[model samples]
Target: MSPAQPSAELLEAAQRPFPDAKAMPPSVYTSTAFLAREIETIFSKEWMCVGRSSSLAQPGDYLTYELAGQPVMVLRDQAGALRAFSNVCLHRMSTLIEGTGNKRAIVCPYHAWTYGLDGRLRGAPFMTATTGFCKDDYVLPSIRCEEWLGWIYITLDRERPSVSTTLAPVADMVSDYGMENYVECFRETHVWDTNWKVLAENFMESYHLPVCHADTVGGHSKLSEMECPPGLAAFNYHWITKEASLPIGNAHPSNTRLEGRWRKTTALLALYPSHLITLTPGYFWYLSLHPKGTGQVAMIFGGGLSPEFMADPRADEYVATLKTLLDDVNVEDRGCTEKVFRGLNAATARAGHLSYLERPIYDFMHYLADRTTGFDRSFALAAE
Candidate 1:
């Protein structure tokens, strides 16, 4: 199908009952025009998870991201408050900073315009002589930013629901985990050769684990043990209980909060548009994804130890073990999703039936249909 072809058939199929649902059309995964529509209607309007609040522990710590093609920066100001602003320099429009790091002020590499951590312009060399050019006239445009359960989120849409409100059910579901107390140990970014949704759907379900992740996490996952439930409005989630492959995946001896199954169970959450999380009793890891056209995805991948594990004497070894396991799992996911994207390009390709295990993907299709096609279907629970 051409990139601009409408996905009416796929949208129609999404409304069917779970037992009859099918995978979304291949065109939806390979369409640049569809991706552009999603950027405007969904990504631009929703709260996007950037990283853990714990990642920015000090004043001057900052990170940059591109949201719906807009450059944005999130940082800790001198007053110890978290703030998000347009990363573009007000003077020449050059991006104020790159990647992640700490600095006393944001300096424009293009010309030397400098802004304080509060995003107030402080210096601009040789521009003072220009007509009415006052540094006081400029301040970086602020973006809506908030922290909930220790995760930092930013949105371009000022009127969107607050993260806390939208994700309250999720917070309640994992309440005993005390997510806010988790400490980030590392974060990294990577670009993958697959459609963003392909990767997201992969994360949302475990049916593929025994096959795709056989070398890493597969041996630890049993499909029959996975719980695929109906999703809520802002997200879709499922659960699984198994002996953790990593010792840290289970509760620490010090943790008294989680009872029986929860100590061994993991919650896999797919937060709409694109944040995916795997929360275990002793650790958490996530992927915050942004699309690069229809065929590639830019991902911020990070994870950390839960408070109980962080306080353990073996914290350093646990961190290393978690990182290594996550790295291996990511490699398997990259290969699997890339192949799916390639298959999507074939002339004979068509979507087939969705397994009960892929219920999250079914909900995700309804979400896309709602935004892109003006479909009136509602995924919200009466109360969550």
Candidate 2:
């Protein structure tokens, strides 16, 4: 079947100049048609962040991810190479795995069909009873998978650019942060009761820090401290300079090259489609968002210390305190984003003017418009 396309009106809206922009129309988030189109045009084709490569530590270690309702898994084969496969058994299309763990071989829970970690079909009990049955032709279908800086990203589309090529701008800007060697020390996954785009937009801006995060990190947010740069090929970023608030804020010493408040500065980066990251000198945290439907989003939230911090004897203490602070902040942000989703659905909800402080939010909206409409309209903020 041919892939679906978004509505012409949506494409027209994307080309509107920034000064004329209001928040996107409600239908973009609440409509069934739009969701289906997005699944076809965006989710299936994008190089999406699933989790960290470190999550699979050994051969046969595996983790599952879903894109547009199709389940797929990432694993290390006997060759120690990372690979991705459809999580459904070829026999009856039953989901093959529920979660992450080490497996000697992948055995389907239902019909006992088995597959090698490399995705080749190994055996299928009783299948020989059927004429013309060929186990050799029944390998689990593979998805495109790649690892960049400890993160594992996968895509259903075979023709797109590699993840590194697509996101090289983000890599260039944060190259000083040493992400390649940074291991994930803490991770949490949850399904939030909000539209996926809402949480993604929430992550790209600090405009609400004072009101939404009043008691947590708000005090550190000064409008002057943020520098919102224009969007580039694969991503957009704004820099925030604030002293460390979590106990582990400085638990690890800063790189000698980054002196002064640059050590405390955090680069808030959003890779197009939906990967958001906070790159700080000492530690990093991220949110990878995916739509569960029009009304819910699955969030993979995680953090880890820089190598310097990980090497510190006091790393454990700092991590404990940092987690607590983030936990509180997350509670605050959840409340705020869920409210926004509810507001978007209301009769009173309407697009609003963009604030310079919310520049990253502006960039993100442009990105969504471009993807949905098949045009690149990412340029120029409304006059300052």
Candidate 3:
């Protein structure tokens, strides 16, 4: 079947509660059954960002990742074409690639069976003469892969809708930003000891900026300065905050280009279910949140923008300031989320409420609800 596209009516339904004032039930964050359903229905079927295209800059370059518990390998073939496949060996079901690296061909470590970059079986020792064995019938299963704004994305269900059709609004947003030319500067991994949903909820709203990130990020950007751009696409908010103070030392003068008091921070272009692309003043950061279980999540953050900003005299200073801000926010957020986890764990707490300012969080929940239950006839019906 062809991929599903967001219809104008569906989009309109998604935007119905535009400036939403309602709060979401706490179960949305703490339920294990909900997480399982999300893994099965949402993550498996959606277009999720895995890594940047630059990671596979040359032929034979590859990266191994797991999404919704399914191991996947993203690689460029000998012909330099990008592709994605289940990272499992067809013969013994062993993982083909352990981690990210460059390889001419993938050889299952359990057995010597080898597969080419295109995921076609290149050789299977001792299997050719086996009774009822057909090499032609055994090739690594392929997954749907797509690229956008230098990022690589994949979907587990081949029968699901195409990535482009599912994310047309996101494409339009990227085009508006001239993202093709935006360069990456730095990418790092962050692991949070809480449910992935908790982290996502924290990121979806700006209500905590004033109290939680006051030291570094709050000093720079005001809570009221944030803006939520319209559309159903995930992670589509924008904020322009002012720098508390100028550079303290002469460590790097190149960053003076961004010496102004105000700093623009986009919530990050989220493709849905997992990938998050955050664009700062001089750099872009992409994060893929892989859920391990009810309370554990592997957050892979990687990506770097161009080095032109670094070449400037104060570039290092600017980068340092931004890094400090992010570090402070992460620390603060992790602490609060950990506390939230404990709160949700309490048997006494039955339900929690979302604030009116946290509309983005509700939007996300509504989207998940629509996708999982299919009870909201408005979305699917509107698309008609």
Better of 1 and 3 by lDDT: 1
Candidate 2 vs candidate 3: the TM-score winner is 2
Tell me the TM-score of each prediction against the true structure.
0.97, 0.93, 0.81
Residues 1-384, model 1: lDDT tens digits? 443465676566766777878899887887777888889898999999999988898999999999999999999999999999999999868988999999999999999999999999999999867998888999999999999999999999999989999999999999998888988899999999999999999999899999999999999899999999988878999999989878898999889999999999999999898999999999999999999988999999999999888988999999999999999999999999999999999989988999999999988888888888876555432222
Across residues 93-204, which tens digit of lDDT does each residue of candidate 2 receive? 9999877889989999998888999888999988778999998988888899999988999999999999988878777777767777776888888889999888888888
The reply for model 3, stretches above 4 Å from the true place, is: 1-23, 174-176, 185-190, 233-236, 241-268, 310-328, 350-353, 375-384
* Residue 331 alpha-carbon offset, candidate 1, angstroms: 0.8
User: Residues 1-384, candidate 3, lDDT per residue (tens digit)?
Assistant: 101222222233344453433433445556666677778888877777777787788999988878778899999998878999999999989988866789998999998899888888888998867999877788888878988767778888778776667776766654534454554445566677887877776766778777777775556556666675433744445444443343321112333333343233344554567666665545665567877776777887654433445566766666676666566667888898888877777768553345655656656665665666554635532543
Candidate 1: segments with Cα more than 4 A from true spot: 1-4, 379-384
In each prediction, how many residue pairs overlap at the backbone (N, C-alpha, C within less than 3 A)?
0, 0, 19
Clashes of 1: 0
The prediction achieving the highest TM-score against the true structure is 1
Q: Residue pairs in steric clash, candidate 2?
A: none
Error of model 1, residue 267, in angstroms = 0.5
Clashing pairs in 1: none
Question: How far does residue 131 in candidate 3 sit from its true spot (Å)?
Answer: 2.9
Listed per candidate, the RMSD to the true structure in angstroms reads: 2.0, 2.9, 6.2
Best by lDDT: 1
